[model samples]
Target chain A: MALADARALVPHLPAFPHDPAGDGAMLMRAVEACERYTPMVAPDGEDALVLDLTGCFEGQGWTRETIARDALAHLARMGLGGRAAHGPTPDAALALARFGMDELADLPVAALALGAEADLALRRAGLRTIGALAARPRAPLAARFGRELPVRLARLLGEEDRRITPHRPAGAIRAERRFAEPLASVAPLLDVIEGLAQRLESVLARRGEGGRRFDVALFRTDGHVARLAVACGRPLRDPPAIRRLFSERLESLSDPLDPGFGYDMARMAVPLAERLENEQRDLACGEGGEAQPDLAPLLDRLAVRFGPDRIRRFHPRDEHLPEYAARPVPPESGPAAWPRPEPGEPPLRPLFLYDPPRPVGVVAEVPDGPPRRFVWRGKHHRVVRHEGPERIAYPWWKHPEGRGPTRDYYRVEDEMGQRFWLFRHGLYASESDHPQWYLHGLFA
Target chain B: MTDSPILRLGSRALSAPVPKGRGVIGLDVPEVDRWLKGGLRRDGLHEFYAPSGSPPGPAMALALLAGMRNCGQGRSLMWLRARGGRRKDGPHAPGLAELGIDPAALLLLELADPADLLVAGVESLRHGGAGAVVLELRGRCRALDLTASRRLALAAERSGTMALIVRGDARPVPSAAHTRWQVSAAPSRALPANAPGHPVFDLQLLRQRGGAEGLHVQLEWNREQAVFRTPIYGDPPAVPAGRAEDRRARRAA
Candidate 1:
């Protein structure tokens, strides 16, 4: 019935517009609560979550039914009403729980969920229950109501099984702690993190490896998970060092962590780890021994506080174009080297390069000549001395029909002794009607 | 002593008269090293400003100085630049390599907020592992007050690393800097074909904490030699390249 007709019939019916998007988002968040059970928790259309709890029931002595019961209990605590069921396959379990059917054989033919038309056709053919649909031959059923009717029947009847694609990949090494009395403040988080880090160190030490990146998750009672991550310059296994880095991260958060109503659980995972060899410390002559201070700690501290992208190092590339010649990367991540300059010559390149080289009005030889004078930013500079037309051709292979025009570069010095690297964009008549001049860089 | 800025009491040059405990290094110029009392103090803070109207000279000078602190010491150098410069492109790597500084070893710290530039500068200064720290504040930095400079100087003193700050479009302000200099471009000596020669700078010692100021000098940079020297004037006329030999004969007559 239309909402207007229903309103007229009832006179006063409190109603709201259907919001599928909001409902979908809320369902996904509610599904996150199942991640505490297993990482292989996946949301199955509109209102259900399918969990693949393979190998999760060992040692704890809890069966699959008990796990589902616990999940439903947690959902109830979060103010969400849900149904729990166990089946041989994800489809069977979803159909069973959604239809509130205890026995699979008693489920209606509509439980196959092959669409309303297929359901109506099957009901007209006297197949009103899933048992009746299963009793019929699959070839006739496929021929009658398309090929998907039989497959949906098989999956809904626990004959076909496939794994669920997990919402998140489980970490290789992780530690979690649950408290009976939820922690109400953020003061002891570092201590808790240090304790977790110590647990992770033993496993890493045995494997002869260390963690380079760590992620911590705080599970709140209100179903909100707060996550923090930090990366290190080197593979680190020391608990105190890891704690220190996290302390810096915690202090620099734009919005401080809020343990709304308290956090009930905390977990730490080493998402990325690398091999690290043992080191020997020399007790004697420790001061000024090699005279090199360890800079990794300080760099990691700064990187955490300000951010990794803020600290960068230049990596020069082998390219014909000046703009692509160099790039900045995170600190110490580049090949630390540079080519030696040509001897017995003034520096050809300017100290600073202007991107989209600034345009200038110039007066020079008509055919092809070095600029005699040029006006840049409305200021005139008379070129007292200059070196030519170091012609650089554009990279032809980079374009389909051949791209940009050749540039004629010049290193010119103005009367004030200021040096500039400018260029003519193209040849006078062949490439363009009139070539344009541009200032590329400034020389100190 | 004469009233001229650089006092040549005798022909022989004197070593910098530094205090008993402190160490100093030279820029390979005798007059400049002497005028600077000893030379730049190892654990000190120095400031370099671009001349009022000039734009490009001081940055290159500071890069050359940073190269001095980078090479032969086996220690990496840290350079901090704020992200809010008016210019689009950053320091050209090939240009830095041409000026004798290794682009790879120079760690570039780009701060998103100009306010964080000083904090990063002071942190890098206190790290003690770096050979030197160069802070590039392109314009007037309101955060770098006397107190902040003092904090940077103290950090530099604690760790034996040097601090150099380069300002692009800024006026001289009161700070805790040991030596302050102004740098601007001068005419380069012409080469064989009237081409611009090595970079020459007209530098002035604007102020020194405990020494003299207003000492002006024209110095040229030699990248291969990794030193600064008195600029040499070329004999060839800056122009008349095409009528060269005939003009020389006429001038000789």
Candidate 2:
């Protein structure tokens, strides 16, 4: 019924505007809460969550009914009202729960999720209930109504099965702990994390594998999930080192972890793992000059405290443009193999390079020749000896509009012996009337 | 011979030899090494400052070369600096490669502030895996005080990694450094085409812990041989214009 008619009949009914985005956010939170039961939880529509409880039943040693009942109670504690059901496929269960009915046969044809016109056409054809549609021959029903109708009908009847893509990929190795009472202190949190790490270590050692990345999910009592993730330089399985990394990560957080209303459970999972072989350690210090201490632990500690991006290794790229020739890569990619320079060539590149190249006032002997004198940063320099203009043409094929102007670069040394790399932006006569000069880099 | 009776000391004590901690990595320039008492100390803290209103490239390059000498082979070279020191385009990798520094063993850390940079520097120095650690600081850093320098010195001594601090336009302060030097760029020899040759550095030893200080030397870097040579002087300046005109005439013919 329209709100106007309802308001006229029963006066003073509070009305608010419809908000689809707000409703979707609330549904996503419900999906996150349902993940405590199984990692394979997906939000069905704007109202319901679908969880594939396949092995969870056997793992927890609980019947399907008890699990569904416990899920509903858990949602209720989080101030959400919902209905739960069990079926062979996720689609059947979602339809049963959304309609708030136990029997699938009594569900209306709207559960097929066809457009409004198709729904009206199906009802007008005297098929108002799914039971009537399922009883008829699927060939004629698809021929008359639509091809999608039979597929939907089959799913509702639990005749076809398709898995739901979960919100998070289920980890191969994981451990979880639940507190009897709400744990409010930070001391016991580390202990709980340590216990979980120990459990995960034994499983990883048995398989001769170690984890490269570990994720910790802390479920607070007030329906909030706080997550922490850390990656190591090398594959690691020792529990104490893992605990220390977590402690360092916690100590460096800007907004410290707050156990609002305490935490209900903590779950630790290894998302990425690699193979690690056990090796015998040397009895004495390593022989010769190769006895270097392990640097991975120190790098890992600093990376956790200060972000990994801050610690980097140089990676060179093969490009003609100076700016795109090199980049700083994060340390986890390991050291990059840089191409060696020619043995006899003098240092052609500069140690420090400026971006957008600092513009300078230049006075050259000829317009198309090398620079004679230039002023930069309020200091004037006379170029005694200079090299030819090494022409580096910009990649014209990369652009769609037209070809970019050619650049004339020169390696000029000032009277002070400080060398500079300068380039003319464009050809003087062909590209523009007046070309600009820029200081690109400085050589030691 | 005819000495006072009260002055009874051994001749070995009279020599007064300076204690060289760990060892020294020579630069191979006979003149500078003689003043350095065998090149720079391997397990010591050394500071480098740029000249007045000049760029820090010369100072930075000098530190890296000395650090590489201490590193030798198979060990890593780490550069630690505070944020805002680099432009959009970072340090050129090819230039370092031309200088014979292996890119695979180079590690860089740009911290949030000066304090964090020092902390990370100390941490890196504590590890023996680091063959050389270069700490680059710009401007006047109040965080790097005497105590922090002392801490870095102690850690470097314990781990046997050479530490080089490059201060750009920053005044020299009292610290536990074993030697301090001021580095500036000097002219290079003209190559065949009258272009600039290799890099040349003019270094002034401002202070040494237990040795003579006011020594000045000019050294030119030879990339092929991976060594420094005293620049050869006493020749007229080459006229680059004449060389260029001659090449043009030959091409036209």
Q: Which has the greatest TM-score?
A: 1
lDDT measured at residue A313 in model 2 versus the true structure, 0 to 100: 83
* Residues A1-444, model 2: lDDT tens digits: 999999999898999999999888877777777777788999876777889888887656668888788678777877888888888788889888888788888999998888899999999999998998989999999998889999988888989888799988889999987777878866777788888999999999998999898899888776667888888888998888899888878888898889878888889999999998887787665566457877787788889989887888888887788877777887767777887766555677887778768899999988988999999988999998777687888877677678777889888899988888899989989996788999988888
* Each prediction's whole-model lDDT (CA): 0.79, 0.82
lDDT of 1 by residue, B106-200 (tens): 77787777678888888878878887888888767889999999999899888878888888878989999888877777788776667788887
For candidate 1, give the DockQ: 0.48
lDDT of 1 by residue, A1-444 (tens): 999999999988999889999888777777676776677888888889998877778765669888888788777777789998878889989888999988898999878887888788888988898887788789988888898887787888778887888777778988877778888999999999999999999989988999999999888877777889999989999999999999999988999999878888788899899998898776664565446577687789889999987777778788887877887787757446788876656777887888878899999966588899999877889999887777887988777696798899999999888888999999878898888999998887
Worst 10 residues of 2 chain B by lDDT: B1-10
In candidate 2 chain A, what residue range of length 10 has the lowest lDDT sum? A282-291
The residue pairs found clashing in candidate 2 are none
